[model samples]
Target chain A: MRGMPVFALGCALALLLAVSAFSDEPARAAGFAWETDYAVALQRAKDEGKPIFLEFR
Target chain B: MRITDLTVVDIGLFDFDADVTLYCFVLNADEQVYLRYGGRDDTSPDAYLNEKSLHAALEKGLDLHGKWKAGELKLPARPAAKKPADYPSVKSEVIDRKQCVHCHHTGSGKTKLAASKGTLDKLKDLWVYPDAANLGLELDADTGITVAKVKGVAKEAGFKAKDEIVKVTGNAVYTWGDLQQRLHEVPHDATSLKFTVRRKGAETELEVTLPEWWRATRIERRSFVHAAEPFPEFWGRELTEDERRKYGVKPGEFGAEVTKFWVKTNAQSAGVQVGDIIYEVDGTRSAPYTGHPALWVRLNRKTGDTIKVKVLRGDKNLEFSFKLRAKAW
Candidate 1:
C-alpha cells in the first residue's frame, strides 16, 4: 500500500548510508593497516624507515 | 611497513600483465623494487598464489630493507616516472572520457596505439609474463620455488621433484615472482638457462636447454592485445593422452586433431582438412610447454607469412603450406 513505498524508500536510504560508512575505509587485519594513497604511504614508509607492500588489483 | 592498496591508479612504472587479478611489489620509499610477489598462468588467476610465498617474500623484503639501510644494498637506478596522464593514448582513452585510469588501460591503450601504427610485434607482444612451467618445472605453490614436478627439458636436464631452487644464473630467488621475473629476462633466442638448486641440503647446478617457442605462453587470456593477433583460421582439439600414446606421439611434440576450419580461410584452401592430426608447423613440433599448438600458430605466425603445416591422416603423413591471413576483427 502507500505505507509500503515509504518503508522501501527508508530501507534504500539506510542501505546507502550503510555502504558509505565502510566504502572509504581501507581494509586492516592482524595489526597490518592498508593505505589507499600511494604518496602518503611512501611518505610514511620513509618516516618509519621501512619498505612498502604495494598491492594492485 | 605499510600495505598500500591501489585502485584507479596509473600503473605506468609498475606495469605487469594486466590480466592478473592481483599483483604485489615490495619496494622502498625511493621506488626501488625489492621483489615482486604475484603471477599466474592461464590455469587460474590464483594459480600461483600462496600465503607462505608472500610471507617468504616479505621476510626477504625486510632483509633487503636492512641491507639498504646499512648502505650495503645496491639497486639499479629507478626508471623515470611516467603516468597515464603523460601517455597520449591513455589520455584520450581514459582521461578524456572522465573515467578512472585503470591498471589495464595502460597496456590496452599502448597496444592499440602500437597496432594502429603498424609497429606492434604480434608474436613478442602477446607473450607477456611467461609461465615457469615452460622450463619444465612446476614449483610447489606453498614452498616458493620447491620443484614439485619436473618434465620435458628440466627432466632431461636432471631436475628432480623436491629440488629447492635457490638461484637463477647465480641471482638468488625467494619466490615464484622472483623466479618468473628472471624468466621474463630470458632472450627469445637464448639456448639454455642455469639453475642453482638445493637438493637434500646440497647445492646442485643444472642447465636447462631452451626449445623453440619456449617463450610462448597462453595469450587467449590476455585481453589487452590478443584480439589483435592473427588467428590460425583452424580449430584444433588436443589429442587425449590415450590418443597420443596410441598414435605414438613423442614427448615435446604438438599432438592435436584439426576439428574445423573457418570458412574461406587460406588453411581450408590449402587442403588442411578436418580430422587431420597436425603435428608440426613451420618446422616447430610443439607449442610452449603446456600450450596448445593451434595457439602457437597464432602467436608465432603473422599475416603474409608462408606456413608449412604437417599433419597425419589415416596412417599417411601429409603437408600443406598456406599464406597466413589477418583475422577479421
Candidate 2:
C-alpha cells in the first residue's frame, strides 16, 4: 500500500516539526524579541533617572 | 544550561542599571534552568533576597528541558521594608488555564513585581506606535486595522499634506479630535466649508463640533496593575513594544491622538475613554485582544464579575456593562 502512504507522509512531517519546535517561545514572544549585546549591552536603563527593577517572566 | 531553577530578583540600584532588569521564566516541563543570585552576606537593608536557592526551585517546578544559560544578573538581599500592597502579587505559579482572546479585562488585570520595597520599574515587552514604527504598520488581523497605517493617513488627511493645511473647515469637522480641534480653532483659517470629513478608506460622513476638552477628564497617575510582559530580557515585569510605544497611547480612528487609561486603586468615579476600543469586558464581546502581553494574563479576578464592554464609538459600536473590578492580589 505504498508503505501505507509513505508511512503517513512520515507521520505528517513529524507532526509539522512538532508544531514548529514548540513555537520558539511563542514566536520570540510574539514580537517582543530581544537579544542585546549592544556590543556588550549594559546601558542598564535611565530613560530619565534610573533605579528600576520589576522583572518577572 | 543545567541546574533547573530561576526566579532571581536582587534589584537595588540608582542609575548604573541603564535600564537593568532581566527575568525570563519559560518553564516547559523537562529539566535544568539555573541562575538565581543575590548576595553580599548582608545583615539586611540591601544584601538582597530571592536567592533562597531560587526559593527551593520555585517550590519545585520550573524545568524547561534544555538550553538555559540565564547568566549575569545582580541585586539581592535588600529585604526589611515590605508593603507595596501586592498588586498582581501572591504567586505559587500554576495557572491551569485562562482564555481572554482580547477584551475581557472586566477582571481588570496587570501588575506583578513582588518583593516589597520602593521604586521598582519595568518596561519589558514594548511596541506602540502612532507616528511611526509598528514596523511601518500593515496589520489588520481581523480589523485591529492599520490598513497600511490607515492608508498612509488617508493619502494625507484626504490628499497629500496639501500645504500642512490651511483649509479643513467648519464646526471644526468630525473626530480626529474634531480635526485636531478644528485646527486649533482656526489657527489662522484657510477656508470655510463643512462636509465634516472622515475618509480614511472612503466612506463619507460629516458632523463636527468638538469642545469641552473633547469630553475631558482623562486622568493619569497610574499603577493599578499595568501588565504587558514577555521579551528578550534586560529587567522584567514586561513593558516593551518600544516600552509600550514610549509610555503608551496608540489609538487611531482618525489620528491626532493621545488617550490612555489603565487605572485602578478605586477607579475614581468611572468616566473612561482614551481611544475607546475595549469591546466587552464585563458583558463579554471583547475585540482585537492581542497586545498587552495578551492582556496581562487576565488579572486573577474577583469581585462580582460582569464587565461586558465594546467601545469604538466612531463608526458606532458602543456597549458596556461594568461590575468586576478586583485583582490586586
**Native contacts, share recovered per candidate:** 0.54, 0.08
Q: List TM-scores for all candidates, in order.
A: 0.68, 0.19
Error of 1 at B312 (Å): 17
- The CA lDDT at B116 in model 2 is 31
**Which ranges of candidate 2 are over 4 A from the true structure?**
A1-57, B1-6, B9-136, B139-150, B154-329
Q: For residues B1-329, what per-residue lDDT tens digits would candidate 1 score against the true structure?
A: 22222233445457566666667777788888887777777677766675456556667777888898899988866666666666576788678887776666666666667777888877676567777788788889876599999999999999999999888888777778778778877776779999999999999999999877677675655666545556676778878788888877776678788887656777788898999988888888864444356777766777778888888998999999888777733
State the lDDT of candidate 2 residue by residue for B52-155, as single tens digits: 32232232212211222233322133334321121233222211123211111211122334213322222211111011111122322221112324233233
Q: Poorest 10 consecutive residues of model 1 chain B by lDDT?
A: B1-10
After superposing candidate 1, which stretches have Cα over 4 Å from the reference?
Answer: A1-33, B1-12, B85-88, B200-203, B227-329
